[model samples]
Target: MESSKIVKALSTVMDPNTGQDLITANMVLHLKVDAPNVSFTLQLPKLDADYKQQLNFACQEAILEVYPEANVHVHMQNPAATAAAGQGSGGPKTNNPLPHVRNIIAVASGKGGVGKSTVAVNLALALQELGGTVGLLDADVYGPSAPTMLGLQGQKPKVERVYGKPKIKPLFAYGMPVMSTGFVVEPEQAVVLRGPRLAGIIRQFFEETIWPPLDYLVVDLPPGTGDVQLTLVQTVPVTGAVLVTTPQEVALADAVKAMNMFFLDSVNVPVLGVVENMSYFTPAELPDNKYYLFGKGGGKTLAKKSQSMLLGEIPLVQSIREGGDEGKPAFVNKEDQVTREAWMKVAKNVARQVAIRNELLPETRRVEMK
Candidate 1:
């Protein structure tokens, strides 16, 4: 007699195509109940007769178990067809690209611990400060740092029904929308996720998240070229990549391997520029002194090799490190004028490089899986 119970019962039925339950998949819509009489529409991925009949029978049998005398009326609809007919907002099944986002900037590195996530988070915030609407996606499945760095740890993105289909709503941090695997699983759980699972999560983040129109979407990629990087280029058209490295030869060596992935003939994503993180050390007490702790000129060297410019050199400062650990990036601390200027400079140069890339070339194509 209650609708909640009816919804719960319907949730038990599964959608074979997606490997999810009906309710979890957001397939059931417009359910009306009058005790013994239940009617609802089911949005399907395909409209094949056998597929439709199978789903319809499953729904009726599920409801019958709860109310033996119930009459169930099942209606079927296809989003792709409806959208093509001008009756829907391109239904959930349409393979529509992110036309609303002007650019997708990927922050990457050849190895870990190069401050790639720090640069990505600060760069995204700095871009927002410069009057551009931006979002962040932490695509590092194994070591998602956004949840901790963004001060959004232990929070989960909410799923809501949009156009009768379920869509994930990103968590907002520091006035920007953000998505990351850290939101769904703990660091311990992420260690076991392999190639296909990682790709599925990355793909879902793009296809299911209801991201608003954005001027730029900053994606923090996993270190080096692997499944996450390959899946990224395949899922969405990356605007460009900002390679991150330190002033060390080993880091630069590995970074070139990552850079070459974008340069490959089949996957030709443009290199935006280079960001040299941890270039030097400047103690808070001695603000005037700069000491080279990790060697020098690695950023510039990589820039020359990649045919791109050095975006900026980020010095190692206590405040910058503490801010990252505490979920308040240095770019927001007005007292750290030097660090703020460094990030803002990177952001500005990135914006300019993206503009130039878009102006001079065609939109980068999504790498097709062979």
Candidate 2:
């Protein structure tokens, strides 16, 4: 019933990494209590798959002894990566550039051809459908597909003067705002700039644009762990990330790498969960049939192995593919109940995971790396 009793229980569980009780090291954060229910976030300074699982069990056991009827929710968070020498001056300070935005989620895949962009686009639409104000940022600068995916091909965001300075207005589609490199260059143009130049472009998106306040901003990142991904993570205060992958060994390998990046000491971005896109196939005619075309359970395995949540498993649907090519994401089509429901499931899971993270952890922002 009292928060202190829960804190006292948590203090009994030793963190394997530090060999100290979580309370002693300031690992417990955002603690709250109600009769027969307790919730708090545990910010582990370091984490691995095995140790994290052990810590969760130990903490739960410790708490249940104090309140046998407790409904315990322990949200795990990784600490902010230490700033490198000459990267920024002083200790880590919150560098939240877009205070108006409630949450910024990066959707990434281990590699290309895994439907990461498709997932990103539909997920944004579905989030909007759930009565939340959402925005989409096509951070894949080299191949900005959000413009086409959102039915905004050949469109450009308008620039307007605001307070004696020029500001770009994000284009709206389905009442949700969007911005992307596709709006600036021709459809076939290649973004051949180096890291520094890419970082500059991303910086402008955060500091210069006049984006409306939003509950969630879904950023579709380019596949693979590259400079663009690093630029966005280092330059922006990403709330969290959702990983996309197929249910195959090869794709799972890369998804592991992508997931690992978020856990890196230099990155330290909390991964909301893993979404297993193209998990399987089911024929349109035979509604009751199922097929393991890409093998099965890769997403669940990855999530379990990484100690992250397996948000949802999306089956391979033809209309889902057709919708993207036709400049209409499947989630927006109300007539296609099957496709819409599949994506809506993922969207709901994503929203739930993000909500837990936001409630438990401090807002993440770009800190100067001195």
Candidate 3:
């Protein structure tokens, strides 16, 4: 029943990367005990798909051996894996000195085409409307959709000098500053870059882009827990992460994996909560009728099981998808409709959760990079 005993048992689990026990690798964080239940998060070095799967199975086995009755939760963190996190100073550099940007949150999904980018775009606009300066970073190097979603397609970022260093100024859209790889490269060209080169490009996007002072910088991450995700976590001092998923078995399953990635020992990024998108489909004609296009409550169930908040559930609206395809998100429209209302609710929930998180953890002063 003692958590210390559980910790000691975990010490036997070795990290293949370091060839040392997880305890010796400093992979365990936030270990807690409550009677018969034991909970802790495991952090791991940036791991490839094969190693990640192997580690996950090994952790489960270790937990069962320690406490067969205890509920075990394993979270994986990939340190210095993505381009954004990898490009930062190798050592413990102080946080970036950007007072205008209060917090940077990444919107991530384990699978693509789940409307993650759409949610991110609307959420950023919604945050701005809630009386905060916002910046949107399209870190989806493979398919940077912010440009199209925000109706800024084919627009190039203006160049400016910041402290004698050249920087690319973000394009403005509805009072929000937006930057994306889409603006820098041809759509067809980006799809061809290899993994390492893609990481370099993402790093360059952060370094070369000129992001002004803002209240929130929401990054739309590339789908999956791969090199790109790892790179961003390492380079940027992300305040937290938001997992987006549809209320379907497949999406929810992958979403849990994405959440586990953040809980990993090396990743250690706080998860704000899970946002359920396309929870139900409602035809415009039948505003009152809600159709369960996908399985119901998958997201809410996942949130409950993980003990994380259910930020909000957005219905499947044709207008929402049409708006994104047309390069104008529904949230930006002033008309009061069901779709707009849904987005507004999601936005408010995100802001409220972020405010609470900020208050609880008090923003870490920007670390200085020497």
Q: Which is the leading candidate under lDDT?
A: 1
Put down candidate 3 lDDT per residue, 1-370, tens digits, no spaces.
7766777787876554323566766678888777566667766544457556766677667777877887766666644344336676553333232323578888999899788999899999888888888889998988899888888888898876432345666788888888898988876683777778877876666555656556789999999898777777656667888889888889888888888988776767778878889888888788999988988888787677556688888888778887888988988666637777777777787788788878887444322222
Q: If scored against the real structure, what TM-score would every candidate get?
A: 0.75, 0.74, 0.71
Q: Name the lDDT of candidate 3.
A: 0.75
Compare candidates 1 and 3 on TM-score and give the better one: 1
Task: Report RMSD (Å) for each prediction in the order shown.
Answer: 8.6, 15.5, 18.5
When summed lDDT is taken over every stretch of 10 residues in candidate 2, the lowest stretch is 78-87
Which TM-score value belongs to model 2?
0.74
Top model number, TM-score: 1
Per candidate, the number of residue pairs that clash is 0, 6, 28
Candidate 2 residue lDDT tens string, 197-308: 8888887776667666689989999988887788887767888999999999999999999999888877888898889988878788876678989999999998887777
C-alpha positional error of residue 346 in candidate 2 after TM-score superposition, expressed in Å: 1.3
For each candidate, the alpha-carbon lDDT, in order, equals 0.88, 0.81, 0.75
Give the true-structure RMSD of model 3. Answer: 18.5
lDDT of 1: 0.88
lDDT of 2: 0.81
